[model samples]
Target: MHPDDLSAAAEVHRLAFVRQKQSEQWLASTLAAFPRFLCFVAEEAGQVLGFILWAQKSGFRDQAVLELDQLAVLPAAQGRGIGRRLIVQSLPLVREQLVRQGSSLKHVIVNTRADNHAQKLYRDTLGAQVEATIRDLYSADEVFMVARQVDEGARGR
Candidate 1:
């Protein structure tokens, strides 16, 4: 995503989680720290519907874990397949990045509220399985989900 998209992207995040808005500053910092190659924004005809931000972390396994740091769609645009598309379109690019770096992708992970309906999106779109739940982790119990040993080819698409 480009810096120009920050305001709209921040608005999408704010509207997506009304009570727990993520500041534009935080989003800007994340965008700056992670290359735009690892970020995907859903847009059409000059409007941004949503975005997905991912980051890579090293693990004990000889590969890296790709974590979904944030994924959100404007409340007005929800349930229109934007979330699913964001994930489906991201994996091959993610795998390409890993391959370009001569590294392997071990898993793709995400953490969300235990009761979040988006959990199903993660599971259905990315083949993620709930690994654990940490109670009261952040305003609510949080569920940790991971897709282990991902195929070089995308499956959830």
Candidate 2:
């Protein structure tokens, strides 16, 4: 996504995540980091329908990890698998980078508001696990539910 896409991206975020604060400059700066940071926009006929932002980081245990920073789909675009496509398209790029760096990436991790319907989509449809509960972290009424991708090779456990 281009720098100009930030405003549209932020609008998508606003529609998906009510309390989150995001700025155009922040998105631009993030995109400046490019390959180190993965960002994607779902668009049709020049209008953005959704966007996702994520980063690659190395765990202290020496494992490569993809942290899904934010994912937002326009309300009108929901249920079309746009969110899934963004994730699916990005994961291989993240894995390829990890392999090039000689690190094993066991899973992709994301955290969402505990009560959000998106959590159900992640768990039941995407097959993510509830790794942990971060209590009262984001807000007094909000709980963070962590999820991890369980790919076949990472399954046994």
Which prediction has the highest lDDT against the true structure?
A: 1
Give stretches of model 1 more than 4 Å off. Answer: 59-62
Candidate 2 whole-model C-alpha lDDT, 0 to 1: 0.68
- lDDT of model 2, residue 44: 84
Give model 1 RMSD, 1 decimal.
2.3
Candidate 1 clashes between residue pairs 3 or more apart in a chain or in different chains: none
- lDDT tens readout by residue for model 2, 32-100: 886667788888899999887877765323475666777888999898987777766655665666677
How do the residues 1-157 of candidate 1 rate in per-residue lDDT, one tens digit apiece? 8899988888887887677755587678888875433777899888989999888865323487889888999888887998888888887887777777777788888999999999888877778899999999888999999988766665554
Provide the global lDDT of candidate 1 against the true structure.
0.81
How far in Å is the alpha carbon of 115 misplaced in model 2?
A: 0.4
Question: Which residue pairs in candidate 2 collide?
Answer: none
Per-model TM-score on C-alpha atoms? 0.89, 0.76
